[model samples]
Target: MLSAVSRALLGALMLSVAAVAAQAQDFPNRPITIVLPYPPGASTEQVARMIQPVMQERLKQPVVIENKPGGNGSIGTLAVARSAPDGHTILLTTNALMTIVPHVQTMPFDPLKDFVPLTTAIRGILGIAVNPNVPAKNVAEFVAYAKANPKKVHFGTAGIGSPQHMAGLLLNREAGIDLVHVPYKGGGPAVNDAMGGHIQAVIATVSSVIGQHKSGLLRIIGIGEKERFAGQPDIQAIAETVPGFEATSWLAFYAPAGTPKAAVDVLNRELVFALNTPEVKQKLFDLGLPVVADKPEELDRRTRSDLKLWGDIAREMNVRAE
Candidate 1:
């Protein structure tokens, strides 16, 4: 006969084991929907398309990717939060949706608790690209020029609360310069405006700026990564000049809270397999994504850390809703 306290502890352990087994059994029986907060052509959308077939094959159900491109990604993200916890619907989005936008606006759901972490779907490096005729040739020169001419160097972004906008703001803070932010509807338009020489600079994803850099339409000043990119070894990271400076655009998958542990595990296993494929890896590399795959726990840690990081930045920089 066991003591009362020991009996209760033993019963709790059994219940926990039973719960784990039960969750693993009833997951992923139907179609899954991946909600993309950005438009179809965005990097996060592209990654969703890349992994769908792989996930479908593993889960034995078609994965549908739905585009909900508005409100700087809060609208779509909130939809996922309010969705059922059946594991059939997941929000696939960048850090901006969870970490940046909420600091600047009123959101419908809590970023920390409303969702279950699935995985970090992808990670991309940021690059500061400017028009060909900009006076600055490198990051140092660009900073100096912007310092000398405050509010004259026009920096365009997708919009306020966007990663690009935050990147611009972070750059301004680090460089101690004031560059006018020219917001656009999307990254494509922002890059177009920069290429047209309407804006002096744009902090965009490496993939978006690489082709233009190759075509001589824009000049690649520096990347916001720890090292040089494999595709473009000529351009160095911005951190080379500004120590402790690094910014990235990453996509992750999240299910509504209370999603079965089985479903999360299945999805995480399938996603990890998809990310390791040769074709997927090559495409991500070509697109300037660093191709980092994380476990659900790691993603949770990252999301929490980044939320605090960006939240602090938003407060310090006085970034407000547009």
Candidate 2:
């Protein structure tokens, strides 16, 4: 019933509409890959697996996790920043990789310009744990002991610019005590030394000491989180005695710059849903992490605020990469 020219025009418009609809519908046709800057078997990798299933269920596509660890997480982080802006790839990393690394090292990519945040994955508190042989039983006791002993109270950390190191510096500044800082290659080594009584204390994630603490091999003196963890109700918060002292580590999901808004939105919605699941929550809790599932704008704001805060901390302490 239509002439050739009219039919051609109608066909072109229909095709355009169909193309847009198809793009929207076929959003996750392929598997999605989440790149982590930490090695396998670490807390970050463990948490990634815990949530991957829930994300897959919500998105109806397989979510794969990749480990590309090195250079204090700078190597894999730069890889993610250079990745395609498509929704297929995502970076699951700690704030240290973005916020602390730039201040510590000469980076290959810009954190602010190279990526857009999708959502905050989790925030974990660091606990001050010590060998059971140490005399301190609480934060105040530890401060008093350290102050009395001075540099005799040796502490270990993952590395110089690591969150562990920053936490130690903050503790020194707040408690007005001088303690020797012994930097190790990673948390594993630092924790091992502490377990062997080679180190007096170490500021580390709760997950890193849950087993040892349960076995009485180590003592958790205080937590950085506002409230006590359900499993460790007996331990008091460091802030209770330190007065205004707190340090927490955060992990987030990010997409490379120029990623489509529709794609970012789709991923963000799925992540929020995935994090809200009971199974995901329990898994994170088991690892001593709390899910944050923030909106994109909220994540953006948090990132900027963290940058400013850490910048101040770095300047105040004169922390430099080694």
Candidate 3:
């Protein structure tokens, strides 16, 4: 009787392993959805659109993009979390939604817990841009102007929990000036508002406003990286003025937690292939984003590290949502 019980347990374990393997093999039998947490025209959406065709061709299944914008990207992120772990649904979002937003607002899903980071697609630095009509030409001038105007100078961002929002907050503290925060549903609108002179400044992904910056519609005075962007060295680093200020962000891909290992592997392999394509690389470079195309483990490590770093910073800054 003892031997029979042991044999039965072994059989059960074997069945479980076989079931998981089968699930992985059959993954993406249906259409795959890549959920965009923000509205159309954001950098995240552009990234998704760039890779969708390649992914579909490689996976041999239709991949659709779904936009669900609100709650600083928590709503769409949570939808992916609650989805089946069969790898049919994925998420394309910025690191801010994972690292900074959760610290400011009560997130419906835990970014680190509820999703598996597939890979980092592209990396870009945050930039500070103002309308051409603004008198400030650089970070120092901007700070002095803000000091004189105090809370009247309105600064906009993609959203309250965005990396831009945190960068703006840190600028206010480090520069010893007050600039009111304005949260937009997406980066596209915020940049537009700045170009239209409705807002005094905006901290956004360089990709979103580089075209306008070159056209004189908006002037990018400072980048939030520790050093100036190599592609556009004319703009000084915000750190040069504020000291120790940085807000680098990445566009990453994710699947729901508990997804089959095989499925995750397939997605990672194909998506990396798509990002490495020459056409895609050129487009990203033109938009001021450097192709990261890192492995799944790399993204996992970054997500964990950034989560801790941003969480502490959020608390120290006492950053509240808009």
Candidate 4:
């Protein structure tokens, strides 16, 4: 009972739906690669390696992890953003790259618009640690020492506009101290310098410096959390002394925008399932990454929220990347 043109439109719509369904069913015809936008041994890389095995088993495809570190994680992220939307290339990176860096540096792609968030792999607690030679036992002592020395206290971070950098900036604002920030290529190098006394202190993820702290090479003075993190209870919260100080970082999975919804669902399901497993959770915890397997929407919301938060912080502190 329909006109010829109307009938043809209906048929075309049905065919499009069928094609998408077929694409979903035939997804992952080839291997999938997770692009890690950070150097090896970073928390993001470590988290990706932890989930790679389980995800491979679930998807029944050979999963490969590729490390492409640069531009504060934008280099590899741009690669994934420009990749085909066939779900073969996934990006595993931190909030800083998506939320913080864009505000400071010109990005090749829109983070929120160019990528579909799959899931948040884990959240890490940031902490402030001092070299053994520095005279600081806790947040209060460190603040006093920094104030007394002024620019003499240098704090190393992963890089400019990184969560570590933001944490140091916030500490300066709240504690009224002047700790010069020394940006490094990555957290590993910063921690190494802190241990070697090349820098007086470092604001980094707890996991990145925990080993050195345990070995007595670097002394962790304060945890950048509202309360003491359950993972490391012995460390006192920086907020306890500074009042309302907190900073944390998260790593997440993302695929190029326009990837099939079916593929996104599958990846999210497998990732959430793998992270919920006790073995995987414990392993992540061992590396100072607490499991935070949330739905894709949750990651999206967090990304948007953090973008604003870091943007404001960067603007207030006049922090920019060149």
Q: What lDDT tens digits, residue by residue, belong to model 3 across residues 1-322?
A: 5598899999999999998888788877889999999888778888888988998898889999999998667889899999998889999998888888788878888888899989898887789999887899999999988889999999899777778888887788778998999989767799989988899998898877888888999999999888887788898998999899887888899999998889999888988999988999888877888788888899999999989977877898787775
> Considering every candidate listed, which one attains the maximal TM-score?
4
Q: What TM-score, over all chains together, does every model reach?
A: 0.90, 0.89, 0.87, 0.92
Q: Please, what are the lDDT tens digits per residue for candidate 4 over residues 1-322?
A: 9999999999999999999898899877789999998778777777777778887887788999999988667789899999999888999888888898898888888989999999998888899999999978888889888889998899999889889999999889989998899999778899989999999999998987898899999999888778887888999999999998878898899999999889999888888998888888998888778898999999999999989888998999899996
Error of 1 at 277 (Å): 1.0
The residue ranges of model 3 lying beyond 4 angstroms of the native Cα positions read 25-28, 133-135, 144-153, 184-189, 192-199
Question: Whole-model Cα lDDT per candidate?
Answer: 0.85, 0.85, 0.87, 0.89
Q: Which is the winner by TM-score between candidate 3 and candidate 4?
A: 4
lDDT of 2 by residue, 210-247 (tens): 88988998999998877777857888988899888888
**Number of the predicted model whose lDDT against the real structure is largest:** 4
Q: In model 4, state the lDDT of residue 75.
A: 86
| Pairs of residues clashing in candidate 3 | none
What TM value does model 1 have?
0.90
Q: Model 3, poorest ten-residue lDDT window?
A: 313-322
Question: How far out, in Å, is residue 128 in model 1?
Answer: 0.8
Clashes by residue pair, model 1? none
Model 4 CA RMSD to the hidden true structure, in angstroms? 2.0
Whole-model lDDT, model 3? 0.87
